[model samples]
Target: MSGIGVLREGPLHAAVKDLLARPGDVTEVKYGRYVIDLVRADGELVEVQTGGFSPLGPKLDALLDEHRMRIVHPVPAQRRIIRVDANGEVLSSRRSPLKGEVWDVFDRLVSFPSLLAHPNLTVEVLLCAEDHIRAPEAGRSRSGRRRRDPGERRLTEVVGSEVLASPADCAALLPDALRAEPFTTRELATAVGCRMILAQRIAYCLRGMEVLTDAGKRGRAPLHVIAA
Candidate 1:
């Protein structure tokens, strides 16, 4: 085991870590330059990455040569915002109107599109319910007076989780209308109900995973189709 212990993890990390661990498996195993999150019963390495994937690539590349690795990343399906005072007292709590979908993971996946293609790698995207804490940011209100600070948001809880594995799983996220059309970032955005930038990322990852292929051009936008 590495010097990093489960007891030291934050609210979200610790919760997800405990959820992924089995009865007899290990937590925080030191493997070469990295400290793995969990070592499963069959020697599979489970990594719970709560942040961007770009920095994880080199470390994973080193491990995947001989080990089976799974990247467990969480996407909050439902989020509650908890406002706290400077002294850490809870002020108010409310649910954010925006609910997250599994498709949202593409936003982060765009940062490292190639990882989806690693043969020895499997990704387990966990859709979860979480609480976000913040101190009001310093600013003025709509009336142009000094406004209460809305603090920086930090993850404070993990309420639930589910897995999304394989490119087929991601393909399922495409809406029926979009799945039938030649893929364009615009069509993808409309289908997924996300911004074009995020849709572009999803397309990039799908392409890297060999799930989509260039199907020439429709007007100016490059066209794509599900890979045959």
Candidate 2:
């Protein structure tokens, strides 16, 4: 298995650090082997926990039973909630209804610390969808044409948002062949590790931003280049 490399502290840790640096009402607590990030918001105690559910789940449930704070679990899309309860008996259990929209799940998860700390706090579960969820490939027919499968279709559609690189970065990363001359959407997509549709969207956005010039169509394919 690939292991993570340790690097100097950077901006990537900003999100976690910012949460830990909250005002006087917020405090970090250590219980057993776990560190609980806690805060009081609107008179409610909020607790934030990360990592896998196996160990964390039981501990959080026990804490909730003792303190009676509401609990929220942000789990990967592939995982479903098995149970939640004050005592040994389960209060609720099921697959999370929320799938896709990762930001919504993260927002709820981050807010849990304050929510749990509240005297009258209510428990909530925020289930996070897995990153890089693959879109199902279109089925192929015997005749070699693509076929639509309704059952396999995802409920959420992924759309291209922003380019991974700026215009300068894109220009620097382009292959020599493409750098010397305008390239087709297919060529750009291959170079950029993205779908043709996403490449087209990036080209359109860059052209609109005056970072790329559209060099007219080559047959049915469009061409693009860095703006002079």
Candidate 3:
């Protein structure tokens, strides 16, 4: 054990937190206004965020003022959608056709573009297998939309991890095959065979991290290139 030993675990959040904690480390402790997820051996506070980053802005701001902090955000590389009835009986199960990539973290990073610049803040991106639990819905949701929340996300296992400790780390997400020339979002999207929106988000984070520089624009799209 590291710090205090596993204090407790239940939901996916706690389970992931427990797994990330150094053996014997404290699990949950109230510090200032936030209930920190784990306190490591060297005193770095670790928070496992499996949700959006918007809500964490204030929490991170408060903690980083006095302590070194790490945000462990997991991106599900493989997901299984398991639909169950209200009683928790499995009704249907299927592997989601969509696969997650490292760039997917940009979806959440868009919420806090400046957080990465903080000296005390580090983000550990974990690629993992997840189980998405949902309940059977009658028809359309109250929003009258086609998509609905997955209800709960349970992490089954970790695949790999990438640490973004500096602006250079952002380049790790880029493919080695990417040309060393200036590229627009459209070109990047076409090269990766991904949606333009995702490419835009990736570009946004790269620019924010100073890993990519704005090379002006082409037509109506912005151009970006790896910083020298």
Candidate 4:
């Protein structure tokens, strides 16, 4: 098994520990500001950085400067590093070129939801490209034909018919008081649980039949009231 596969075997906590344990020039500290994952190497702070720009970046920079140490931020392989000077002016950046199985593992293993929900960690997923990855297919049945139960079919048909028939039935059942009162296309639609466009068409038909009349415009939308 690859290193990435081994890393993926355990829970997130163990996976993160394994990532930090990789032989490097730096020694990782388990916790830092707000108990987030932090590492130290040769007195410099090392952080695995993901997501986009936010206040946390500046705050971490400030903390590192306060401790008189430099920071090494390992960003995702596809992302570009952003550098801000002492005055917060963007200095320079280069697109990260390192791509491998381990990088993919790192991307998936990181719990973005947990990080975003953290009270102290204000990490937010912005402009993520991972949605482009296609979903895996589930195993297919041996026989190609799909089978449907009769009860399920009847239930589905009933639900579909009700959804299709409700609006027309509701319009037919409109109270005499409401039908007599002046209403807009939208108001009538709201009362009948139908689309405004459909309501307008119905009102137009009713007007031609002398059962409804256009009561002029309410703002840009048309209004209709019952005709005597």
Candidate 5:
């Protein structure tokens, strides 16, 4: 783990790290008690997290006070499922119907929403396509069927990206109406045209970033207003 992280990570994580790294960036350097993914020549810290952000709380707390930190998160906008045989030959390939949206980052952000309060912290969401590789294995599923679990995820292409570095940046994700008016999570959901759960996460992050303020309650739901 002390060596280059790319060497130990999966195909997709390694690829994304390589894509985000610039010349002169040091990969997998130790800082304090944490093993950071990389440190830029400019002394900035970059972490490429391929999954949940929950585990990053300690790292952010330990580093954000002294160093500029950038978190790189990949959201699979599209996925191609590839079934490979024992010989590693492609058995089949198909595009999944489920699509990923940039807003989906909030799902993971829900855990450390308040971390955005740090001026030195920045979250960069990568919208990309990936290949999901799976191979048959001798096992049983929870329901007693043959095991068919998700395997590796390999980066195919980066489609786009968005950066949330400040309150204004996060505000831009909300609908104009919700951005300016006091609203509940349910109202935010309808206004943004997203589900209530997503709206709740969006609201949670906004409040943590100080972009929104407590406005008492409307019915059983807590209402929030944009910070002036």
Candidate 6:
């Protein structure tokens, strides 16, 4: 509601943009042939990206050379499922059992792993609680029953944040146990309490940032060692 741009953006994106707005910040302004979400009075660029980092890759490549940019990506730490009818009446509400962590950013960062080494870039993981709204779809399915489609996410409260400003910050995401020894992705997974895929992404990003390098192999799995 802070700017006319809110009318076009999704509820969650607009909410976070307004939350980050300062007194002299410009919202939804066009600069250097791209429409940025917000720009501070001192000319700092703020981008609130709620999806994959792939699409933002070119924009960063285009602007990072001349400006300081902060990319804000929100991870919902807690979610409340809200079901509503076609008439916009709330039907039921429940809490989701799944929780999100700061490490989830690696899932998106894989699109541009080396960007972390850029001196002018900062990636902030914003942790928040939000409403995951669902509404009935227009038509019936094979069983003649209506299906519920996910709607926009509505922000409830911001809980915390993690700032990844350098390659060292990326390396710190690994547990201490993995720091001193060469390890495989499987071992990294166990150390971080995450799935093999997530662990692989973390390693991929770290290696791209020059924080880790190959150190031969442990059996068939390739081994990685902390860079000296």
Question: Could you give me the TM-score of model 1 versus the true structure?
Answer: 0.84
Better by lDDT, candidate 6 or 4: 6
TM-score of 2: 0.31
Per-residue accuracy of model 6 over 11-93 as CA lDDT, tens digit each:
89989998999999988887667788999889999999988989898899899989999999999999998888878899989
Q: State the lDDT of candidate 3 residue by residue for 22-83, as single tens digits.
A: 76578677786667778887899988887788878888878787899998888889999999
lDDT (C-alpha, whole model) for all candidates: 0.76, 0.44, 0.80, 0.37, 0.85, 0.89
User: What is the Cα-based TM-score of model 5?
Assistant: 0.86
Which of candidates 5 and 6 is the stronger one according to lDDT? Answer: 6
Q: How accurate is candidate 6 locally (lDDT)?
A: 0.89
lDDT of candidate model 4 versus the reference: 0.37
Better of 3 and 6 by lDDT: 6
By lDDT rank, best first, the candidates go: 6, 5, 3, 1, 2, 4
Candidate 3: misplaced stretches above 4 Å? 1-10, 141-144, 147-149
Regions of model 1 farther than 4 Å from truth: 5-9, 140-165
Q: Which sequence of candidate numbers ranks them by TM-score, best first?
A: 6, 3, 5, 1, 2, 4
Prediction-by-prediction clash tally:
8, 13, 8, 2, 0, 0
Q: What is the per-residue lDDT of model 1 for residues 1-228, given as tens digits with 9 covering 90 to 100? A: 455756656667767878778887998998877888899989999987777888777877789879888888877777888887789898889998887777777777877666666666777767777778877655777889987554433454445554545677667666778666686888888878888888888898889877888989989999988865
Residue 72 alpha-carbon offset, candidate 6, angstroms = 0.3
Worst 10 residues of 5 by lDDT: 1-10
For every model shown, what is its TM-score relative to the native structure? 0.84, 0.31, 0.87, 0.25, 0.86, 0.91
Model 4 Cα shift for residue 192 (angstroms)? 0.4
Model 5: per-residue Cα lDDT over 1-228, one tens digit each = 246444678888888877877888887898868888878899999998988998889988788899999999998999998888889999889999877877888888889887776799999999999999998554886889987767999999999999998778887777788765678988988887678888888888888888889999988989998888
Residue pairs clashing, model 5: none
Error of 4 at 137 (Å): 15
Can you list the residue pairs that collide in candidate 1? 135-150, 135-151, 136-149, 136-150, 136-151, 137-149, 137-150, 137-151
